[model samples]
Target: MEKKLTKDDLKEIENQLSCPSGSKGIEVAVSMNVKNISMTKASIDLLKIANNDVILEIGHGNCGHLEYLLNQAANIHYIGLEISKTMNQEAILNSNSLGTSMNTSFELYDGEKLPFENNSIDKIFTVNTIYFWKNPNVFLQEISRVLKKNGVCILTFAQKKFMQTLPFVNTKFKLYSTEDIILLVNNTPFSITDTIHKKENIKSKAGDDVDREYTITILKQ
Candidate 1:
């Protein structure tokens, strides 16, 4: 039998999908490990992380993927930027529990500004967080500013057609097609180097099977 979602459950899912800010949101994020696993794998694979690479992840909820990245390469420094205070702290705790605290750090921010020096980051990546970007240009500019010359940035998100099938992607969520994302990035200082598309079936919070199309766009700073 398919499990049903309550109104509060749906609300919490929406919060997790959008911003993931509070205690309830943190719980929802932890529960989403299954969905995040594949996306994280794809993003990491696209990242091509090297030894001693300075990497930053935007909107890293619960930091489960950070553990995966740390385990992939030794001495790779990672910084995570999240707008949610609870999630920021939860990610820090998650890293500590995984024994990755030595190389990982989390920061709470307003989602538009980045707190890194110019040309300081070697690589950056974000997954499933673009919908919550209040100002895409500002975030893109920040990414360009912090990334060293020829640094890589990988962005992973579900395409608009697939995202529209989800009930929680309401007005609060900003949906974008592949072209829209390309256009947005073209306006930034970075250049789109490659785009990878994949389709997968996943069960929704309401326990219904849904088909999702994931896009990973690699950019060079």
Candidate 2:
């Protein structure tokens, strides 16, 4: 199991994402979008994030999308937990530098045991990292502790069905299929809301099969 990343480790991850050509969000989104038609459809639903909800993300990884989402939601309070210091700091600095007035907090915290009071969150989400948990049961339980009743959580990842379609598959990251994720969801405290399978196509990619991802949404029950 991977230990919680330290500040230096966070910075290392940040440096990698800041590379202009490919990024954590861009790469994942591109591959996922083509993996299935439903992948893009599901991500579009992510924009339904309410203006007044308290939103949280477990593995922000220096992502720009969540911050952009926050900007779109002036009445929403957003928080992101990133294990990497550089990624967290870059997110803070770059986001603030953009001069938006959204209220937000970024913490260097353990993704497994979020340090929030019970029933404190309105909405929670993560992407591409839940399977790495050494104890996913405990991890989801912790998330349940902080979420309000009826609050929603969306977990998205690369689809196992799309393995044949990846433009460049990195063996480092783990991947799961929709059925696999549904089992984990069933074991958790949340009730399944929707499972969206989507395929994304990259410009000039050789095969039509490349780049699909699935996003699953569940409501805290």
Report the number of the highest-TM-score candidate: 1
Q: How well does candidate 1 score on lDDT at residue 2?
A: 54
lDDT of each: 0.84, 0.61
Tens digits of lDDT, candidate 2, 1-221: 43555555445443443221234544433433243334323542563777788888776655456445665555888787876665676668756876643677888775567989999998887765664555777888888889888677777676676643543334333457777767876888877776665555543222332344445655457
Task: Spell out the clash pairs found in candidate 1.
Answer: none
Predicted structure 1, TM vs. truth: 0.94
Candidate 2, superposed: residue stretches over 4 Å from native: 1-44, 163-172, 203-209
Residue 161, model 1: Cα distance from true site in angstroms: 0.3
lDDT of 2 at 49: 71
For model 1, what is the C-alpha lDDT against the true structure? 0.84
